[model samples]
Target: MAEVNYKQDMPPKGGYAPIVFQNIPVKKYFNGYTMFAGFAAITSFSFYMYYQNFKRRRLLKIERQDAINALEPILLAERDRSYLKQLRRNVEEEAELMKNVPGWEVGTYYGEPIYKTVPKEKLLDPILEEYYAHTSEKAYDDKANEFLWR
Candidate 1:
């Protein structure tokens, strides 16, 4: 067995420093006023952004309304023309269908007026489906079967 020589380590002059058990207090970098100012700045910026978004939405809505207003007259004219054409067609259909009847008028049951009380009789226009109801059995069946499940 070989012999080994070792030097023992020793603590410097005064023994080890005392162990600290209590927590050390740290100084705050920002005071209450500074923190409050930062929060206010962030909040104000967010509100400004929200206001900008609101303005953009309002502008877009106004533009859409203007576009709709500009197109209204043309659309109304087209609708009127379509309605008059349908009315003419309805009158012709009634005349053809009632040709065999003795005294059946186009808008009335007989030669008498359809509306008696009113000074100016306003005839109710039937919808396209109702106007063609008597033309085909299929149309009648479709109307009858409509909402059957309900």
Candidate 2:
């Protein structure tokens, strides 16, 4: 690598030489107060950046703590909750509601459910249509008969 000399070799200040406006060296031309202000600015910027990072992490930790607190209720509420007991209660209630329905009893069928009669008209039964509406994906089916009561 070639090194370019940027400094001018000069004689020492052994002889009294008249100092003119442009005759001063680079050091003599520097403003100490301005350099000190620049150092202060750099130091302040570094401190500001460090404080911002610390604040961001602190905020994240607080948000995580809030999330944990919010989820505490659901977690603690299940301490004595029995899923099987609730399921049994729901089944008993459902049985009670269907007990008095004329000619309708708690029954299950194998494979796809088959209706006693085919629907002869559009939107004939709301109950059967509602069941299909909730169960079927209701997308990409070109024929409404896929869910028709038949």
Per-residue lDDT tens digits for candidate 2, residues 9-77, read 788888668767775555565488988999999999999999999999999999999999999999777
Per-residue CA lDDT of candidate 1, range 1-150, in tens?
999999889998889999999989998999999999999999999999999999999999999999999999999999889767766777798899899999898777598766777454565767657666545777656766788957
In order, the Cα lDDT scores of the candidates are 0.81, 0.61
Give me candidate 1's TM-score against the actual structure. 0.53
Model 1 alpha-carbon drift over 4 Å, by segment: 1-34, 117-150
Q: Clashing residue pairs in candidate 2, if any?
A: none
Predicted structure with the largest lDDT when compared to the true one: 1
Q: What is the lDDT of residue 71 in candidate 2?
A: 90
